[model samples]
Target: MRERTMNLLKLNIVVLIEKYKKVTDVARELQLKQPTVTFHMKSLEEELGVPLFHSRKGRIVLTEAGRALYPYAQKMLSLHNEALRTMEEYKGMGRGTLRVGAEPAVQSLMMPVIADFLKRHPGIRIEVQVEPEQKLKALLMVEEIDAAIIEERAALELPLAFERWNEDEVVLICAADHPWVLLEELDPGQAGQERFVRHAPGSQLDRIGQAWADQHAINLWSPLTAASPEGVCRAVRAGAGVAFFSRKALAGNEANEGGGIRMLKVPGLEDPRLQLGAAYRKEGSPASLINEFVHFLRTCAQI
Candidate 1:
C-alpha cells in the first residue's frame, strides 16, 4: 500500500487562490511572491491528481473539486488556529478576539447588552461592524465575521442558523405637534392625507409597514424614506412625517420630551412585531464566547 503524502501548505495555497480567485491577489494577501503562490497551486493540483481551478484569460475560477475542498481547508485552518490558542491558554495566555456585525438599529439597544456580555467575558476582545442587513448576511456567509444581530430576517439567504434573542412590537410614532398625535387612534382613511416617514423599500420594517397599510386600505403619502431606523426616528422627531418603530426603540424617551413623540398603535395591525436575533453560519464550530453572548441576550430579553 502506497502512503499518500498530504501537503498542508499546498492545500492552504489552493484554498487562498480559490477564495481570492486570482493568484496575484492571493499572493499579495498572503504576503508571498506570486510565483510562490502559483507554484504551490500547481503542486497541489498534481498531488491531488486533478485540476483544482480553471484558468481563463488570467482569471482563476474554482473547479468542482476546488469548491468541494474549500470548506475542508477552511475547517483545517480553523482547527490549526484553535490548537495554537489552546497552547497559548496552557501557557497562561487567555485572550482572543471576537468579530461581530450588527444592523444599525440594534447598535443602540443591543450594545448595552453586549457591554454586559463583555464584562462577563473580559478576556474576549470584541469588534463590532455596523452594516445593513444584506451586507451583514454577506459577511457572515463569507466567514468574515463570527456572528451578527439583524432586524429584518427575510432578506438573508445564507446557510446560517438564528436564535431569537428579543422581540418588540412595532408602533407608529409621530412628533407630538403632528396632527396625528391628536387622534385617539390612526384611521386608515386618513392615512393617505398625512405625510409619512418610513424605512427604505425592502427593509423588513418597511415591508411590514406597507403590508399593514395595504391590509387596512391605507395609502401612505410617504414624504421621506430613510435607510436606518434612527434616521426614521429622527425624521419623525423633526416633524418630517410619521414613522413606524419598535416600542423598545422609543422606551427611554418621555412622550413630551423635545416637544415629544407619540407612539400610536397602527389601527388593525395585529402584533406588528420584529424578532431580533444572533445569526451565524450553520456549519462552523460555535465559539463559546458567541454562545455565551447569545445566552446573555436571551436572558436580557426574558428579564
Candidate 2:
C-alpha cells in the first residue's frame, strides 16, 4: 500500500482554496506566500497521484478529485485544530478533562475534588470511576485513566509515580442493637469471639482490621464478608456484625439512623495503616488538568 504524505499544511491549503477560490486570497488568509501555497497544493496532488484543482477564470477551483477529497481534507484540518486547542487551552489557564479512578474506601475523598475542580475551572470535567485497588492499578498501568486515588500499601508493581493524599485511619462501627454500641470505648481484648462484618479480603480495610485485631490479641470472627461499603453497612445495620472503614468513607453519610449503627473508638487499635494517595504512570506526561487536580488534592486539606 502507498504511504500517505498528506499533512496539516496541505489540508489547510485545500480547505482554503475551496473557500477562497483564488491562490492569492487563499495565501492571504493562511498568511502563506502564494508560491508556497501553490507548491503545497501541487505536492499534495502529486503525493496522491491525482489532479486536485485547476484554474478557472483566473481563480483556482477544485477539480472532481479535489471535490471528492474536500470533506476528508476539511475533517483533517478540523481535527488538527481541535488537537492544538485541546493541548493549549489548559496551558492558557482553561480546564481540560480529567479521567480518574479510585477505590470505594476513598471515594468520598476522591469525589469532592470533582466539584471543587469544576467550580474553579468551569471548562474542566472530572470523571471518577470507583473500582478495587487491583483493577485501578491495572488501569493506571495502561493509562486508561490519567490518575488514581487509592489505598497505598506495598509499593505498587506497576510503573507509576505518586504523592500521599491521606493517611486513612480506620473507624470501627456496629449496629445500634449490637452490645458494643452504647460503650464509648471498645477494648479489642474484650472483642473475644464477637462477630464482625468485614469488607472482602485483600481490601485495605480488611488488612487494617486484621492487623488491629492481631495487635490487640483479639480473636474476631467474621460471620459475614462484604464486597462493598454498602454491603458492610447493611450487614452491620442489620445486627449481623460490626465493621471498619476510613472516616472519610462514612463522613456525613447516614450510616446509622434511629440507632442503626454506632462508631466505636477501639482502644489500642493500631494507627491508621491505609495510606491513600494520587498515582499516575511514571512514563506518562500528565496534562495540566491532571497536575492541577493533583495539586487540589494536596492542598484541599480535608477529605
Candidate 3:
C-alpha cells in the first residue's frame, strides 16, 4: 500500500494544539468532533513517524519535533491566507506585518500617532521597538527592522533612504523656582556656575548641550547623567539642574504652559536642532507598506 499523505488540516490541528494545548479547544476551533480531530492527529503522527504532542493532565503539550514544525506550519498557513486575500482583493490590498524601530523620545511622543495609523489600517499589523539612534541605524542597515524614526542623522552615513518629517529645537529647561529660570537673559557662560543634569555622553542631546557650552567658554559641571529623556525631565523637575529638551517634548505640558519650568534661549550659542526622519533600506524594500506608513506619518505631522 502507498504511504498516507499529510494535509493542511493535520498541520492546522498541530498548530491549534500547540496554541491552546487542549483537544476540546482545538476541536471547537476546527469545528470538528473531538474523536475525529484525535484520529487525524494519530494519523499524522504515524505518517511522520514521530509523536507530535504529549498528553499531561488531560492537556496537550507539543513535543520537541512538534515545536520545530510549528513555525513552518504557521508560515505556510499565513502565506495561503495572504494569497487568498490578495486574489480576492484583486491585488489592491496592503496587508502584512510592519516592524519599526524608534528612539525613546520618538517612541513616547510619536506612538499615539502610530497607534492611530494601526487603527486606520486594521489589516496591517505593527510592532514597534525602542532603541537608541545608533542601534536603530544599525538595525536598519542590517535589514532587521522595516524602518526607523530617529533624531540626528549626522553620526552614521549608512546607505539608506530618509525623509525629513519635522525639526525641533533643543531648549534649556530648569525648575520654575531654580535661580537660572529667573535670569533676564540666559547665556551659555552660566553653565559652569550651575550644576547640570546631563544625558549620557553618547546621546545626541548630550553632545549638543556639551558643544554649546564649550563654544561659549563655559565649563559643564555634570554630576549626574541620565540615559532616558524621562529621567532627565524628572531630575530637572526635582531641581537637579538645567538640562536640554526638545521643544516638542515640553509643548502642551502644564509646566511649560503655566511656567512651572522655564525654557531659556542660550545667547551666542548655536541653537542645537534635530531633524526627525523616517528611514528605510534602499535595496529590495517593501515599497507599498513603506509608502503607506510614510504617508501616514506625514498626515500626522500635518495635524
Candidate 4:
C-alpha cells in the first residue's frame, strides 16, 4: 500500500540510486527486491507530482526534482541518525539548562552556533551571559555559568581549565573618506592622536582598545562611546571617529558599517594569536550539560 506521506525509505532509495545508478544495486542495499524498489520510486514520484529519476539505457539517474530533494533528504536522515546518537550519548536532554558566558566578540561569532544547538535540542534552554573574561571567571567560581568563551586579550590564568577554540583579529575601522583609511603604512604611536569612537567603557573591547593605546603610548581620544558595537561602527561610518572591532563581528554586521566604513590595519594590532577559548570550573567534575555545551563550543566556534 502507498503511504500518504513522504517516506524516508523512498528518499533513501533516490539517494542510493544516485550512488549506485542501478535498480538492482539499490534494491540489494535496501533489502528490497528490484520490483518493490521500482514501485516505491513510482509512488514517491506520483506523490510529489514530479519524476525523481530517469533511466538512461540501463542506468538510473536522478532528475532535477531528485537533485533538489537530495540535500534535504540527506539532512533528514542525518538528523534521524543524530537523534539516535544523542539518545545513546546521554540518558536524556529533555529538560535542562546550559548557562553560557561569552565576551561580545565571541558572542558575535557564536550566536548562530548557539541558535542551531538550541533548535536541535528544543527541550534545553540556553542562558547566555555576555561579559568580560574576568567577570566570567568569577561566575565560574560561583558556578553561575556552565561554560565561558573568552577572548585571548581578556583571558587570564584562572584556576579553571581553558581550551582555545577559534582565533580572530581586531581590526580598526574608519569612515571611507577618512585620511587614514587608504594609508598603507599606519603608525601606532600616533593612533591616540586621532579622534575615536569606542564601545561602552569597561567592556572587553574597550579594554582592548585602551590597552593597545597604552602599549603604544598613544593618548587615544574618544568623543563618543557607544553601548553597542553597531553604535560604535555607526559613529565611525558617520566620520565621528574610528573604533576597534572583531573582524568576525564586522563581517556579520554589515548594517553597522554601511558603505562608508573601511577596515584599517594598524601596526600593533591584527594578530591571529588573539584567539578565543572556552573556560570552565576545575574544582569538581562538570555536569553532563556543561560537558555537552563545551563540546558544542569547541566544534562550532571555528569557521
Candidate 5:
C-alpha cells in the first residue's frame, strides 16, 4: 500500500482511540462516510494480523493490541505536523505559525518585535508563551517553540543556535530625588546600608544582580521583593527602595520628569548589561522560519 494509505490508518486509529470512540463520530470528524471509517478500521486490524478494536457496552474501544500501537500513531502524526511546517517555510514567509518562547524579563522587548512581525507577515500566525529561563530552554529543545528570546548567557550553555538579539541595560533605579541621585556614582559599600527592593528570588535578573554583588563583596540590604521588572520599577518609584532593572522596565518613564525613577550608576558595577539573544535548536527546526524571524529580531534590536 502507499504511504498515504498507512497515514490514513494511523489517523483513523488515533482519532478512534483518543478522540471520537464511535465509528460514526470518527467518520464525521475525518469528513468521511461511516462505512469508510469502518473499512479502514477493519483494514488496519487485518494488516497487523490482530484484532485492534472491539465494542464494549455499545461504545467502540481499543483492544490491548490497539492500545500498544497508539503511542506510535501519535508519534507518526507529530512527525507529520513537523514535516508540514518545515515545508511551509520553503513556500514563503507569508504563511506559517510561529511559536515563540520568552522569559519574563524579556517580555517588554518582545511585544514590539512580535507586533511588527505580524504586521509585515499578515498571514503568519504567532503564539507567544512566557516561561522561566529553564522552562523556555526545555521547550526549545523539544521543538515546542520555534525560537526564544532570553539572556544570551543562559542560551550559551544550551545546544542551540544563538544570535545576540538585543542589549538590555541592567541599571540600578531609585526615586528621582533620592539622596544617591546627587552623587556622581553610588558607592558599592553604601548599597549595603540602604534599604533595597530586590527582584524576586531565583529570577534571572535576581541571580545576575546577586552574582555581581557577591563578586564585589557587597551585601544588599533587601527587605522587599518584586516578581516582575514592572513591579520592581513601580516599587522603586513608590520609594520602596532602590532595585536593579533592565532598561525595558523603564520604558516610557525613564528620565521623564513625571516618572519618579532614576537610573543610577554604581562604582565597580562591571558591565551592568545583559545581552538578550534569539535561540533555537541547532537541529530539526524549520531553518527558513528561524532565519526569517532572527532577521526581524536583528532589525528590532537596532531601534
Candidate 6:
C-alpha cells in the first residue's frame, strides 16, 4: 500500500458513506463536479489498497476498512480545524470560535458569563449548547464541544479535567408571610413536616433535596413541583409550598422582588450548597479559549 495522507481522505469518504451516500449528492455537497468526487474516492481506496466502498441497495456504503477509518477521519478533521484556530490565535488575530456546553440548570449563571466574555472580546465567536451533564460530557469527549459547565458532583465523576469554579448555596425559600419565614432557623424536623415545593424530578436541586431528606430520615411530601427555578420561585411566592433553591437562582436578593419570598436558614443539614465546576478534555482542541472562558465563569461567580 502507498503512504496514506489526510489529503487523500479529505472527508470525501465520510460525506459519501455517512451523509450523501451517492456520488452526485456528495459532489453537490462538496461543491465539486461528480467526476472530481469520484476521483477522490478512487484515490483514497487505491492508497489504502482496499475496497473501502461498494454499491449496495443503490446506495454508496463503506466496507469494513472504510468503516474503520471513519472515526479517524472525523478526528483528523476536528484537529485540522483546531489547528487553524490555534494558528489564528498565535498570529494575534484575537479571533476564534469557542463551543461551550452547560447543563440546563446552570444556564442562567452561564449566560451572563458568556455575555460578559463576548463583550470583552467582540471578535471571538462562542456557541453554547445546553444539555444534560452526561450529554455534555459525551460531546466534550468527541470534540463536539470545547468545554462544559456542570454540577461539581457530576463533573468530578467524569474522566475529564475539571476545575471547581463556584459554589451555589441552596437556601430554603417560602412565601414572605409564611409562618416559617418568622423563624430565625428551622431544624430538619420542622422542614420535614412542611409541604415542599420541589424542583422537577431528576433536576440537580431535586437530587440534592432528596439526598438531604434521606440523610435526615425525613420523608419529604412534595405536593408541588416546578420544572425550572423561576417556576419554583413563583410557586413559593404564590404560597403553594416551600422549596430549597440556589442563591444564584434567586439573583442574590433574599427578599426576591418586593419581599414576595423569603430565604430561610436551615440547621443540622449535611450540605446546603451546590458546587459547580467547568470540565474539558485535556487534548485535541483549543486550550487557550477554554481556559479564558473558564476564567470568565469564575469572575462571574464572584459577582
Which residue pairs of candidate 5 clash? none
Q: In each prediction, how many residue pairs overlap at the backbone (N, C-alpha, C within less than 3 A)? A: 0, 0, 0, 0, 0, 0
Pairs in clash, predicted candidate 4: none
Estimate, for each residue in 1-303, the C-alpha lDDT of model 1 and write its tens digit.
Answer: 534554667667767777777888888878889898878877777777888889888789888998888888888877888998886763442556768887765676777877887787677677998776667778888888888887535425656778777777778888878887777766767765678887866555677778887887778888788887767877888888887777776774333356467788877776677788888765543465566666677777732
How many residue pairs in model 4 have overlapping backbones?
0
Candidate that beats the other on TM-score, 4 or 6, i.e. the better one = 4
Model 6 worst lDDT window (10 residues): 8-17
Q: Candidate 2 residues 1-303, lDDT tens each? A: 778789888988888889989999988998988899889989999899999999988888999999999999889888888989977886864856678887767776666667877888888777788877777787877778888887656326556777677776677877767778666666766665578887877666776778777876777789799887878887888888778877657664555446576776656764555677888765564566677777787887443
Candidate models: Cα lDDT each: 0.74, 0.76, 0.76, 0.77, 0.76, 0.77
Q: Which stretches of candidate 4 lie over 4 Å from their true place?
A: 1-91, 270-272, 283-286, 301-303
Model 4, 1-303: lDDT tens digits are 655678889888878998999999999998999999999999999988898999999999999989999888888888888888766555466557788888765677778878988886787888999875567877888888877888654556666777677777778888889888667778886567788887776666787788888877788888888877777777888888888877777787755644677776656864534578778765533376666666776777563
Model 5 TM-score (2 dp): 0.66
Candidates in order: C-alpha RMSD to true structure:
15.2, 3.8, 11.4, 15.9, 11.1, 12.9
**TM-score, predicted candidate 4 vs. hidden true structure:** 0.64
Residue pairs clashing, model 3: none
TM-score of 2: 0.76
User: Residue-wise lDDT of candidate 6 within 16-133, one digit each (tens)?
Assistant: 5677678788878778888887888887777778887889999898888888988888888788889888787744537778998876567787777788788988878989987756
Return whichever of 1 and 3 wins on lDDT.
Answer: 3
Q: Show where candidate 1 strays beyond 4 Å.
A: 1-93, 151-158, 200-202, 214-219, 253-259
- Model 2 CA deviation exceeding 4 Å by range: 1-6, 14-38, 44-76, 90-96, 152-160, 166-168, 181-186, 216-219, 273-275
lDDT digits (tens) for residues 12-110 of candidate 5: 455565566787787777788888778888877776778888888887888888888787888888788888886765568866777898877788778
Q: Specify the poorest-scoring 10-residue window by lDDT in model 5.
A: 2-11
Q: Kindly list the per-residue Cα lDDT of model 3 for residues 1-303, writing each as its tens digit.
A: 649787889989989998899999999999999999999999999998899889999899999999998998898888889889886543343566778887765665677778898788777778898776778777887888988887646423677777667677777888878887667886556656788888766566776777777777777888998777777777888888888777776764433445567777756655457788788865525666777788787766632
